[model samples]
Target: MSDSTSDFLAADAHAQRRYAPLTRVIFRLLLAGLSGFLLCVPWLSASLYWVGWFAWVPLLFALRDTRPWAALLLGWVAGTLCSAGGSYWLAEFMVNLKQVRPLLSTLLALLFWCYLGLVIGLGCLLYRWWVRRLGGWDLLAFPVAMVSVMALYPMLFKTHFADGQVDFLPALQAIDLTGAPGLDAVMMLFSVLIYRLLTPRRSPAAAYSRLAQGTAWALLALWLGYGYINLYEWDRRMQQWDTRRVGLVQPNDAITLGIPEPATGFTRESPPEMLATERLVAAGAQWVAWPEARYKGYFDDYSVRDSYARAITRHGVPLIFHDVERRWVDAQRISFNTVALLDEQGELAAQYRKMLRMPFGEYLPEPWSWPLLKGLTDLVFGEFLRPLGAGSEHIAFDLNGMRVVPKVCYEAAFPGFVAEAIHTDGAGKMLLFLSQDNWFGETSQPFHHGNMSILRGVENRVPMAHLINNGPSLVTAPNGRRLASSEAFNRAELLADVPFSEQAGGSFYSRHPQLFLNLIYGLAGMLILLAGWRGRSRVRRRGRRCSRKTRPTGN
Candidate 1:
């Protein structure tokens, strides 16, 4: 239109052209590969979580200057690699622990990684579309699309039973309102902003790009500020807790559930679990928790019955044990990972059947129930393919002063499940998480599982006590502080206080879960629709313009 406007447009075109070299197929592949590896490193260790902040920056940079299709495929390569790297532990679990045949395990691993990669790839496609199609709103649109990618990650990426974006504490502090999806949004925003900040600009609106950079910094500042404020409040709230002394007994006796024999080099003769319980009571524990499948037989067996009864009556304290119960479900027999509470008077108080089963570890699919498959599972793989059917109802136990919610292993990762269990019975209860961590052995699986439990505790504002076979058994306060813990595979009894918050307030996340996420998902959907409409309108406009230009003069 105007000369100044023409110059501005030309400058924009030049700037856009500057990124043209990055569009080469070779460069796209390399950039994507590099990005995937970078993203994977931070998650490999518990200590390297800091790496996540900028891990996707490189990928973002590469994607920003490319065609939508090229960017999508490039992102797929990175996403696939990232998923595989984070979950490489699965291959180990299959071969070394479950001893699933190599070919099958590899195939399963591939399928899982690819599925996760597909989610990420699709996310990249959306990001490219939004940033390219949205004119004035590119800055805002990019982060929103990025958030959609990350928000879906927690729900979709289950191959490793992961929540990488959730584990970032600064972002996690705001999880009460945002839940997992919101935290993910914050992370994607940070990544997009960081890339934009680092990216050089030649556009006439470079000042606006710089402003976006400033906004990104401001957002980061706000996130950290709010996070620290929440942390301070978390501590202040915990200070007013009416604490109850609790004990976690780590027996170090581990068995592959449903396996006929136990792993070698384990404490063969039960590792004095009764002794550990006594130590817990002596250490001033009003109640003690035990690991899953803690004893050889149920309380019906005289030995287990006498020991548990004596522990309750002798110490005048309740003892909790989690064991597997077999039952018929739909005329098919399956085991239930169940927890039973023994009161001070040596009477059975209540029981909780595990409701949330780990996808692969616990809840194997029905297809594996075929006779041939079952035979292979027994002969080739000594471990159970499927140990249990999920429990139908939530159960809680009262320990004189307060009620305690019980969740078996793997359920700790599901924040909503724990929140519901606590909310159903009203607030002011501690969560007892029982586990046999032996299958994970000394890997990051145990650590990853434990870290996620912190999110659960904080979200519901509930204290949690974890007792594990082959532990690092721990007690986490409502604010996610570790009150007590023992080293893994150690014979020890942990004593800690269940920091029951005196504050009568519950978390917003508990009262209304997934509310923010649903809105975010809706917004993402709208943006996608808008992007599509805009794309079609541009195509139609270009066609009309070409028709006018190509019309023969007086023809």
Candidate 2:
């Protein structure tokens, strides 16, 4: 055979081998699993956070030269695997706390994983579509698509590429300017650059590629540089600010049927939490915080009020604690998950009700609350589903003239919610995040929950004390540094000299929280339009060429 014929035969055989069913499936699964593992490890432990910088490289590689539908499938597989691995605590939480059967708990966890996976699948689909229309501009197309999906997609628990970078303090500082979504975009850009560097054959011209890489590195340096500067500035400001001894009490209470036993009753003259509070006060704690749900009964109850009053009056130190608030609204008994403050005299200074209630945990959503499904929901959820009233206002507690804003449980996870709370309360001086994480047990859940407080503090330039009932309570400075922390599942008390600046909440992000996110949305829109225009122009050019070729030799 001739050389060209032999070469063609060889190429045909290679294509056949590459497209074989078993080979393709194995390769795809390997790539997806690898990407998922890389993404999950960082979420499991902060020490592994550096792994997230290139976590998506394998997924990008798998999607290369693949059809949109195939790319979507690969991305979904990777994303589902990542979420399932990282959030394996969910199954345990469901089975132990929510009273779900083992099989049903597993299935629910799977559904949750798949739901989050759709965001990644959609992002991959968009990326492939853009590549087909506008060539391999992964640098721009990939980040924009991923960031847009993460920003727009709604989930019970929101996840972002930046979540894995929570421990990377220097990188986290930029969040004050751009929010988590911006950090996500930056991380995506880094992943794309790494992918391009690894697969030079698939990248742009060598000079252009080098320039892009250089620019990315330069920007990264500037980003970290800004972080260092802010870190120093915040630290300096903290030194000059008024300092007060703050204490966090972790009860480490036992949970039964998803509710903490300590939360329900305080029959003892001095419960463990109260004793801890007394000890902290003796240790010179000017202000103390107790985790959410520690006092479950109605705060209006005379007994409960008396108990809180006795504790606060005895110590003569301001205290913040959580309880259930009852109100008679239109002859209906409505309850609220509330965090309240008591002055030195044990008077109720202020109370902030939890605004963002956990979907199934605290309140049932639309379909579940619908009349038709009420029976099934009630049967399945049982007493675990106690719908609480939502709060309309963000109340701040005054501690020695400093305003302290309070967030209950997962409310701190939301950037806008925390920012609004601070802004609404005249730029609150400190943030007190009250949480009960016992339902999830000693899993990575507590760590993940605590990590969120880091960004919230940094974004608003305020000190934060995240007090959890099941430990891993922490104190964070405005620079995202953890001043003190306790291990999960351990009953512990933490005391840190938390500083509060007279000038609080002037961070650019605090004033204009949505500015960066809106810019990202605009950029994504612009890219989509550009891709469509390019595709249309290509089709028109091809149409003209075909018309010229089909015209008979009229000349």
Candidate 3:
């Protein structure tokens, strides 16, 4: 009886020991998912953005003993979860705003999530490959590889939610050097540090080395110092110029095409748009702005044109509005999505058309040219989408003696586009982002848009005014501060004193963006190739040694 009891106890102990590794793996996977969710969305609270700094630490530890293929799979799970969690609003928007079916919208969301998730999975695969090849020096290689992979990853799967990934402004000051991709590098570095602190190393070789810690710390210090200096320089520059009072006229009106509501879509501009602009100018606005695509057919419609002239003539202020112009040259019809600025004399001073159009939203891609895709879109949207041509030139409006760069809607998300515009006037530039965020409803997408768009001002040392429909017109200063923001989904106006810096240099980013990214790409590529070659050479030498040892001593 005693022997049987002992046997049973021994078997139970063995089983527990066998299942321990699996249990650890499960726990680590959960950690990775949680960490990924927190890092990319800051779903808990905006203030808890610090969680992103080391969110990938658990995943790094989890991948310690994983094969390259296994790492890819694990990464897919984590990345998919991360993408889905971050963009949960996309599904809601499709259903509520775009009127897509719930199931179909969810499936669309899933497809996009998986596509973006591949970047993370491939990064994991590459990480495993390097860890195998570099062995002890992997800590040194990690950040470099991570930065390159992340920088390239988003090009394949572009989404501008990078703000939630790293919210450290001192670190973000380095954006002029590496753009937002630099934040991903810092996040990877932090993950490595966290892993070193928490994970125990059983061998001297397995010990986490402080190889990149100096580079990381040096970078942080440099960024902070640069940020301080940049702000100081901007302040010095600001003192040289007079402030302009820019007014944002947000008419909180629901858009219903073919259905005339109080202040919606080119309805003689009476209920809100004209009223708001008039009030703002009366209150001492030098330039008043409106949101995107507010009027469907501006130039062709006499009433809309008359309304625009009436407002400018009465207010005696430059009024900016979302407009379109149709040109029929050589029997080819073309439409321009434009922001038209009317001078105080009630005449069109300048117009900036949208160059970068959204795929499917503004224009459909080649896939949608396929019959299947066309059919799908037709079914969902009730018709094939109108294809909008790209604008060739970057046009700026001269408002109240200041060069105002206009970014229509999602164009603000493109940093280079905005940078080019900031550099257009040579110096002393202000910015306006005419956006209609109504389609997103009350989702976190507006927050994402705000986070992504505000960074442009920081990069170029320019002040930005966002005149968004469905509310939340605001300004972001050069110091990365958001001010004078109106409430979302409300008919409100933001009149703020906006200042422009007379600094001649657009920014370091403008002068040499290609250099920074090229260096990163070249370094990352060489390291990978060199490590892989060394690994192969070591294998060859080991094989030769094994053959020699097995020669039987020539007996």
Judging by TM-score against the true structure, name the best candidate.
Answer: 2
Candidate 3 global TM-score? 0.91
Against the true structure, candidate 2 reaches a TM-score of: 0.92
> Which 10-residue span in candidate 3 carries the lowest summed lDDT?
257-266
Question: For residues 252-350, what per-residue lDDT tens digits would candidate 2 score against the true structure?
Answer: 877764434443454544466778899999999998888974445546557767887887898799988887888988898888888888899989888
TM-score per candidate, in order? 0.84, 0.92, 0.91
Error of 1 at 508 (Å): 0.5
Best by lDDT: 2
**List of clashing residue pairs for candidate 2:** none
lDDT of 3 by residue, 255-341 (tens): 543324444343554546777777888899888888873554557877767777876787688888886677775698987787888
What is the C-alpha lDDT profile of model 1 across 231-312, one tens digit per residue?
7787887776677898877767655434444234433233366667778788899888878844445533566566567656
Task: Show model 1 residue runs off by greater than 4 Å.
Answer: 1-24, 102-107, 136-143, 146-170, 205-219, 257-271, 293-295, 299-303, 328-334, 360-363, 366-386, 424-426, 502-505
Q: Any runs in candidate 3 off by more than 4 Å, and if so which?
A: 43-45, 154-157, 160-162, 165-168, 208-211, 236-240, 257-266, 269-271, 380-382, 423-426, 502-505
When 2 and 3 are scored with lDDT, the better candidate is 2
Q: What is each predicted model's overall lDDT from 0 to 1?
A: 0.70, 0.81, 0.70
Estimate the TM-score for candidate 1: 0.84
